[model samples]
Target: MHLLFIADPLHSFKIYKDTTFAMMREAYRRGHTLSVCEPQHITWQRGSRVSAQVLGITLTGDPTQWYEAQPLRRAELKDFDAVLMRKDPPFDSEYFYATHLLEQAERDGARVFNKPRALRDHPEKLAIMEFPEFIGPTLVTRDAQDIRRFHAEHQDIILKPLDGMGGMGIFRVGPDGLNLGSITETLNRHGAQSVMVQKFLPEIVDGDKRVLIIGGKPVPFCLARIPQGSEVRGNLAAGGKGVARPLSDRDWEIGNALGPVLQERGLLLAGVDVIGDCVTEINVTSPTCFQEIFDQTGCDVAKLFIDALELAISAGD
Candidate 1:
């Protein structure tokens, strides 16, 4: 089978922790051809079939030189056996445009995993709103007054931009509310942009768990991102400690509850974020932490994903 992964540039991959790189390695080991292209490489002019300038690639043992690419070739989306959308987020206008192109490919009979429309429909931070029972006090608004009201209602709260990833733009305002007005303006652009405010989960001290759901089931273990020093964010990009452990019962329950619904919606993989028993985010676009859990637990998450991918392909046939 030939697999085409639409993702970040292959040269930019940090193999030790990049989930896309891990998937490539696992796929190559299983004798499947691999091709890669950045989102910008996709082009669909007047009469074209939504093709891409894709480069066939092979993996190397050396981490620094992980991929060797062949000359670029243009292929219609239907040419590949599977297409994995593994682009990281800032899900801005460009990212949004990429999904529309991929969705056109899907219509042309390309099997794109974690389906494009699903990605657009479920923005990470606001996705948890689908399950109010699983979330804490949350507000999504651009109004400074609304944020102030929410903060007043919940003394400790977290404010963040809905499009932000990797702990960026996250601020915790406590009882003192020293910089509430300023933060509201900065995050919201003074009533122009929307921002999210949720009650701060004190259980963050324990860890912010990333529970990966693939092919409609839980991974059995999770990578807990524990905040460092005075930081309130438990994102690995923010220098949080990644500790892998077995999934807690509550975690399993949440995963099981959401898995089937997500699968039905064409989301093949999801990384559900949890602090204590409440889900804080449902990461559909480029959900990560596969390597961290593997390095600690010896559970080959990449292999699991590949196996599921193969099954999905065969079932599609």
Candidate 2:
């Protein structure tokens, strides 16, 4: 099978921990041809199928110069056996527009994973709201008074922008309400933008566990991104240490409950974030931690993902 990865630059990947690289390597080990393109390389004309200027690449098994690539050439998205969307986020306007193009490619018969419309519909931060039973006390709003009210109720709260990734712009307000107003204004831009406010789960010290669901099934292990020092965010990008461990019962519950539902919505892969027993975020956009989990638990998450991908493709056929 030929797989086309719509992702960030291949050169930018940290092969040791990059999930997309792990997936590509696993797929290549199984004898699949690989091609790649950035979202900006995709284009569509009024009367033509959506296509990308892609580079055919062969992995070198060397991280420094990982892959040898051919010159970019135009190819219709539908021509590939599978098109994997692995672009990282800020999910800004460009990413939004890219999804529309991918959706159009779907209409042209392209097999796109984590389906385009599904990605657009599930904003990572906002996605957790759907499963309130599994999450902490949460509120989504742009109004300062609403945030203040939530903060007053929770005493200890977390505030973050709706579109943030990698723990950017996240703030913790304690009982003293220190800088709660400032954080709210900063996160919501003085009511111009919306933010997510939740009761701070003290269990964050244990780690922010990433429960990966592939093909509507939970991976046996999850990577726990534990906060270091005085940091509150447990994201790996925020300098947290990653430790892979077997899924806890609550992790399994959340994963099992959301997996089939999200899969039905065309999400081939999802990373459900749990801090203690509460679901914090539902990460569908380029979810990572494949390498960390595999390194510690020997659970082969990327292989599971690719297996699911193959099954999905076959079923579609």
Candidate 3:
């Protein structure tokens, strides 16, 4: 299969722990040619097909230089066997527009993994609301009064901006509610921005586990991103220590329940963030942790992903 990865720049990848690099390497190992492009490379002229400035790359085993690639060439998006939207987010307006172009590509018969419309539909933070049983008591609002009410009821609550990633702009308001008004102002922007408020789970001290779902089935192992020192955010990017572990019963239950359903909904890959027994987030836009799990547990996540991708492509054919 010839795979085109709509991702960040090839030179910017930290290949050591990057899951997109992991997928590219696995696809190369399986004798599939791979091309890469940033989301901004996409273009759709008035009557021409959706196209992109893409570069076909060969994997180099060298650690410092991971890929050997040619110059960017314009290519029709529908020409590839699969288009993998693997860009990490701020998921801002630019990302939103890229999805529209990909949606058009899909209409031109491009088989994109995790589907464009699905990505647009399931905004990571908002998607959790659908599976209320697996999450803690949560509220979404920009109104200061509503947030205060939720914090008053929950006592200890977590506050976060809806557009944040890597745990940016997250706050914890306890019984004393220190900086509550200020934090609300910063996050909600005087009711112009919406933020998510959830009852703070005591179980976060254990670890925030990332359960990978490929082809709607949960991987047996997960990366438990343990918070270091006083930091409350357990994201690896936020200085959390990633430790791979077997899935707990609750982890298994949540992953299994969400996996097939999300797949049926056209999200082929997902990283469900599990804090204790409850799921905190469903990562659809480039879900990660493939390398951490494989390095720690030898679970072969990349292979599983490629196998699933192959199956999906074959099914489409």
Q: Estimate each model's TM-score.
A: 0.98, 0.99, 0.98
Give the alpha carbon lDDT tens digit for every residue of 221-271 in model 3. Answer: 999888899999899989999999999899889988999889998898999
Cα displacement (Å) at residue 280, model 2: 0.6
Question: What C-alpha lDDT values do all the predictions have?
Answer: 0.92, 0.93, 0.92
Q: Runs in model 3 with CA error above 4 Å?
A: none
State the weakest 10-residue window (summed lDDT) of model 2.
181-190
What's model 2's overall lDDT?
A: 0.93
Residues 1-317 of candidate 1: C-alpha lDDT, one tens digit per residue: 99999998776788889999889889999999999888999988877788999999888777777778899999998889999999898899999999999999988899999889999999998889889999899999999989989989999999999889999999999999989999999999989999999999999998999999999899999999999999999999999999998999999999999999998888889999999999999999899999999999999999989988999899992
Following a full C-alpha superposition, what root-mean-square deviation does model 3 have from the true structure?
A: 0.9
Clashing pairs in 3: none
Q: Highest lDDT, which number?
A: 2
Instruction: Assess the local accuracy of residue 242 in candidate 1 as a C-alpha lDDT between 0 and 100.
Output: 95
Clash pairs detected, candidate 1: none
